[model samples]
Target: MRPFLFLGTRAEDLAADGEYDAVLRFSGLAERDLRRVRLERDELPPLDLDDWSGIVLGGGPYNVSDPDDLKSPAQRRAEARLADLAEQVVDADFPFLGACYGIGTLGRLRGGAVDRTFAEPIGAVTVTLTDAGRTDPLTADLPGSFDVFLGHKEAVSALPGGAVLLATAPSCPVQAFRIGTRVYATQFHPELDVDALCTRIEVYRHHGYFEPAAAEAVKAAARTATVTEPTRLLARFVELFARR
Candidate 1:
């Protein structure tokens, strides 16, 4: 079977690897079936969509809506590469699933608004499916409202043209969306479980998702969260697109 590609942007070693492991676990993919790419440490190559079954984008510390003057050199480069790739992916209607940071990237690429208007604090929150979401193959089986791990400084204020809104929350309207029938994006970390959320809370304590003093509280909340439904989306993506 052709392997799926996982593009990640975490610069820290432990956080990066942990994210990869979480993806693999939630997607139910073995190492041999998933090719991981660290966008922080390497440049995106000329991609040929036919070579991989699908693409999965992981969350990162970079906020696409940040001012140009505030963006680090690394963030600039990574964003540029992802912007180019987003065009190709969308034009082809390729199979893609972007989490957190991916939503901001795809939202901006499609000429939609992405800003801090709907920033959510760290921890699990209720995500409710819209009518469209209840019928979409990726979210059809999910409960109408379920808990998901999310913490983002920026969110897709409005979905792009021709995109279908899926899950939503009071704090953030565009919790999930789909472009055409295949490409998907979510403002939450569907790849995270309790342990994974705890790990991220500790690793990103100083990255400004919240006050450092609140890290313990965030981790404690993560430990108690019953976030099983969101992970099913990861498995569903793989099951629907993985090459046989």
Candidate 2:
């Protein structure tokens, strides 16, 4: 089996590693089978889809829907690179799964509306699977409703062109979606646990997902969340694409 490519976009050392570790844990990929790349510090190579089993994109502090002037140089570069990759991935229907930031990047790339109107606070939320989600191979085994961790400043306002809505929450309508059967995106962090959320809350305190004064409360709330179901989506992505 070819190695899976994991792209992460976090500048902070601990935050970046935490994202990678989550993907590694949920996907059940060995160190050798998973090739992790920090997009915040590295250039995106020409993605030859055949060279990798699939691509996994992790959450980040950058928001794609932000105004041009507010975007940093690194964010701009990452967005451009991801847009280019999204085109290729969609055109070829390549195997891919994007979490958090993935929804904004790929959703916007595919002509969907992504905005801050549906932003969710940092915590766990109940997400119900749609009829399509119930039958979709990636989500079929998942419970009809389950909890997942999510914190974002922007979300998909509607389904992207040619995308299927898989799961949804009251806070954000488009919680999870799939494109061309092989490509998937989720607003929630499928790989996160309480410890992981605490780490992120600490690392990203000033990034405005929540007020600094609320950090302790946020961490405490995260501790009480039961979100074991979403990890299955990550494992399912690996199981479906690792050999091909």
Candidate 3:
């Protein structure tokens, strides 16, 4: 199988490897079968859907619904590129899994409203799979409710007509959704665990997920945060999509 294309920004350190590590941790892709393209730092090459098994988009700081003026040229380009790729993915019902920010990018393409009104902060929260989620191919076996790490400032306010609402939480109505047979999105960090979330809480403290001084508390919360079996279903996602 061809290498799965891992698209997203470059995390200076912990994320330096970007979704590569996440994919490794959660998917069937080995280091050799995964190739990462940091859209923030590199000019994305033309895409050929046949070149890989599937596409996996990681989370980022950019919010798609934000004003155009607020988006950097790099972000704009990245979104456009991803949007173009999304159309192809949707057209073929290609295998795809988008985490966190991936929801906004694909959600926007599917005519869903992406906004900050329902944005959730960094930490762990119980995500209840909707009836649709309970029946979804990806989430069918997941518990009705489970704790998963999350850190987003935007959510799907209105789902596109054909999209299935896979998961929801009191904090954010659209925790996860699916556009087609193989395309999926989530507001939670399926790639993250307690130890990983604490790292992000510390890095993003001053950046705003919580009060600057509350980093410790947030870290504590993350430490005790529960990681559900469903979250690791993302690995199964990789096994199906990335290793095809």
Candidate 4:
């Protein structure tokens, strides 16, 4: 079976590795089934879509809404590469799932309005499925309304043209959406479980998701919150796309 590719940009090794592990854990994929490429550490390798079952983009600290002048050289380079790859992925309606930071990539490509308008605080939020979401193969099996872990500095304020809204939270309207039958993106971290969330809380405590002093509080909250439902999305994606 062809492995799925996971693209990530976390500069912190611990956070980066943890994100990949969480994805593999939830997707029910073995190390051989899921390969990773760290965008921050190196250039995006030349990709042949047919060589992999699908692609998954993980979350990161960079915000697509940030001004060009403010972006680091690495951020600029990563965005350029992602934009190019996203064009091909979306055009083909390839099996792709982007969590958190993905909404920005696919959102912008489809002409969605992305900004800081819907910044959600660090914690869990109730995500509701839209009518389309209720029927989408990837999300239909999830509860009509379930708790998801999320914390974003910016979000897609408007749904992209031709995109279908899959899931939404009161604070973040575009919790999840699909560009076509196969391309998908979510504003929340479906890869995150309780332990994974805590790991990030510590690694990114000073990265501004929350007050550094509130690190313990944020972690405590994550430990107490029940955030299990979102992981199903990962499993469903793998089930639908894994090539034999």
The residue-by-residue lDDT of candidate 4 on 1-244, one tens digit each, is: 9999999999999999999998999899999889898998789877999999999999999899999999999999999999999899988889999999898888887567889999998899999999999999999999999999989999999888899999987787899999989999999999988888888889998988888999999888878888879998999999999986
Give all candidates' CA lDDT scores.
0.91, 0.90, 0.78, 0.91
lDDT of 1 by residue, 110-229 (tens): 569999999999888999999999999999999999999999999998779889999999989999999988999999998988888888888998999999999998888778888889
Q: Write the per-residue lDDT of candidate 2 for residues 1-244, one digit (tens) a residue.
A: 8999999999999989888887888889987888988888889989789899999999989998889999988889888999999889988989989999889878986568899899989999999999999999999999999999999999998678889999998889899999997988999998898899999999999998899999999999988888889888888898888864
- Candidate with more favorable, higher TM-score: 1 or 3: 1
lDDT of 3 by residue, 45-164 (tens): 877778888777888777788799988888888888888888888888887888887788788865678888897778778889888888877888789999888888788888866898
Candidate 2 residue 98 Cα shift, in angstroms, is 0.2
Alpha-carbon RMSD of each model: 1.0, 1.0, 1.7, 0.9
The residue-level lDDT of candidate 1 at 49 comes to 91
Q: What lDDT does model 2 reach?
A: 0.90
Collision count of model 2 = 0
Q: Poorest 10 consecutive residues of model 1 by lDDT?
A: 102-111
lDDT of 4: 0.91
Model 1 off-target regions past 4 Å? none
Candidate 2 clashing pairs, residues 3+ apart or interchain = none
lDDT of 3 at 3: 77
Ranking by lDDT: 4, 1, 2, 3
Selected candidate, larger TM-score, 2 vs 3: 2
